[model samples]
Target: MGEHSKALEYYEKSIKIKEISLPLAHPDLATFCSCIGGVYSKMGEYSKALEYYEKSLKIREKSRPSTPPDLATLYNNVGQLYGKMEEYSKALPFLEEALGIFGKSLPSTHINIKIVMNAIDRVKEKL
Candidate 1:
């Protein structure tokens, strides 16, 4: 935790290794791409984050259905990143998707559903 840079460096290396060893369209590789995007987003690198997040989403969509928590998590993550970037318009769709997934998969009163609902509301206010 204290050495975030070092941690990210290792993650990047591992991601590259996965890319070389796995199929180009592998979901695991997509997950790694999403992790990279999240790291970049946390570092306040919006463009890089958006690029990788989109790549992850595309790969996941192609390989699996969109209802998995993995897909919802990515949607929420990218939406939150967009929210942080003040791109509220773009954030809504992702947040909405996350909300839908949780609503369908989890109980109505689940914490995750509430969290996504709040996120959607926040984005709506901004837009």
Candidate 2:
């Protein structure tokens, strides 16, 4: 089940299926890459995680409409990874980018956007 240990495997399977069936640079594939990247991050393979995340970002940039939610989510993921690695300076840019995206996509009163903004502020303060 998805809630169990097979979650990552399922995500990978889905990604592979999408990659074969979908067009190049499809948003679904990009989302799959992001999911895989998150899994890699959880597994403590930061480099691999980053590689997937970057790949996802590229696909989103090329294929998706420039929606704030999408860019912000990707940036937040990259920023969080860098934050985990103690690369605060590198993290700041990504977090800032995410914040900018949120600013455009969601209203200021939106809970998730505000939460992301708070996180960016906290990280910036630490940096």
Q: How many steric clashes between backbone atoms does each model show?
A: 0, 0
RMSD of 1: 1.7
Tell me the tens digit of each residue's lDDT in model 1 across 74-95.
9998999899999999999999
lDDT of 2 by residue, 17-95 (tens): 8988999789888888999898888888899899999999999988967765977899999998988888889888888
Q: List the residue pairs that clash in candidate 2.
A: none
RMSD to true structure for each model, in Å? 1.7, 2.4
Instruction: Output the worst ten-in-a-row residue range by lDDT, candidate 1.
Output: 1-10
RMSD of 2: 2.4
Candidate no. 1 TM-score: 0.91
Query: Which residue ranges in model 2 land beyond 4 Å of their true spot?
Result: 1-5
